[model samples]
Target: MAAIPAPLSHTVAAIDAAYVAAARNGDSLGVSMSQVIHPCDRALFYQFRWCAAPEPATGQRQRIFETGNVYERRLLDMLRMIGCDVFEIDETTGKQFRVELAGGHIRGKMDAVATGLPEAPETPHVVETKSANDKSFKAIVKGPVRETKPEHHAQLQLYMHAEGLRRGLYLVVNKNTDEIHAERVEYDPAFCLAIIARIERIVALDAPPARLHDDPTKKGAVECMFCSARAVV
Candidate 1:
């Protein structure tokens, strides 16, 4: 006789449980470069300290993250197809290009470094990849990533600075339309220095810094609304 199959709910629960188990442990010994640009100082502190038990992403959220990873690989392939010399791994380290600062308290990994682009074939540029939903994609397409997505712009700047590169390529994929947008970003030394100093200050602090805002629901507090440390802060 054929065996019985599990119920849909049970199957989904099992999958979600696996994702939760596979999630990165919330514990951190230092501040991640990814969080260096966060607008809220206290939120970054809380994350660095793991003050509140970090909640693992929901099953749906985990799937969404995986989807972004899938697209990242595709983006790398497309760059190679266009004759760009893409280096996803560092030969020296035999791993992804990594940046660490502030006595290793701040760290990050870049997506890749590419050379031989049509615009500036001679210059090596840091490559950053992203995937966006419809609304976010539309905002990016409107132009000026520095304004529409300041965090992403800051991230690329940090990557370029760490890699000693003067230029970066920001490639974003629109999930809804399958459209890709590419932009060339120039490194800003002043911005990099400012943020680095900011990271060092935050890492050296003994307690959480001042909250960006008192009311999480107030106008322009959108970031606060979703912050994990909202209650504690």
Candidate 2:
């Protein structure tokens, strides 16, 4: 391998920095299933209602998110090539299936509601796709999502319930090795109801909920380190 010149490296760095800045500004209307299933209520409230400040993503974080989308697109194509009919858009409306709750204050654009798969060829499946690094991939394969990743489990449950689907296929692609893992998630109505109840409570609040930890200003607080509401500044 040859080392790049300093000028070329600096030029590419500047372009990435500009792209990250532009990507950081987006106008989200309401709470998506991703935040609802997460652990921190304060972070959820802050992001959903745009009350507290949020630090924008770094160039590296933006690149990581974009890479995951690339993985998802490639996997969807492979499934289609293998004879599975993946429906990313509605047949009539030509839009991804949209679910709105709480009078459109809470919503999600479902990834896909797919049909004609080898697992459940007769019934439509809510397809929840993810890409994981090696350690997380190993944990995901070892146990039910209830133990390994409850947030993602709840996310699938909510989507399936909203779509009136009784079954779903959870797909994970390992980034390190390109290994694929799949799980079938049966719909749970109770879980969906609970999640919806919480969303309503959070959104209806006058102010943001308490921080995930008692003293988020502390240097070593557990929640401060993890909460998205804790901005870099």
The top-ranked prediction according to TM-score is 1
Model 2 regions lying over 4 Å from their true place: 1-8, 21-24, 91-95, 217-221, 231-233
Residue 233 lDDT in model 2?
24
* Displacement of the residue 43 alpha carbon in candidate 1, Å: 1.9
Worst lDDT 10-window in candidate 2: 224-233
lDDT of 1 by residue, 1-233 (tens): 99898667988898998887777753387776667788888887888777777766787878888999999989999999999899999899899888776667677778999999999999999998999999999999887778888888887998888788999999999999999999999999999899888877887899889888877789989889888778784
**What is candidate 2's lDDT per residue for 47-111, written digit by digit as tens?**
78676555566777788888999998777777788788888887778887787766665677677
Q: Count the backbone clashes (under 3 Å) in each candidate.
A: 0, 0
Off by over 4 Å in 1: 1-7, 217-219
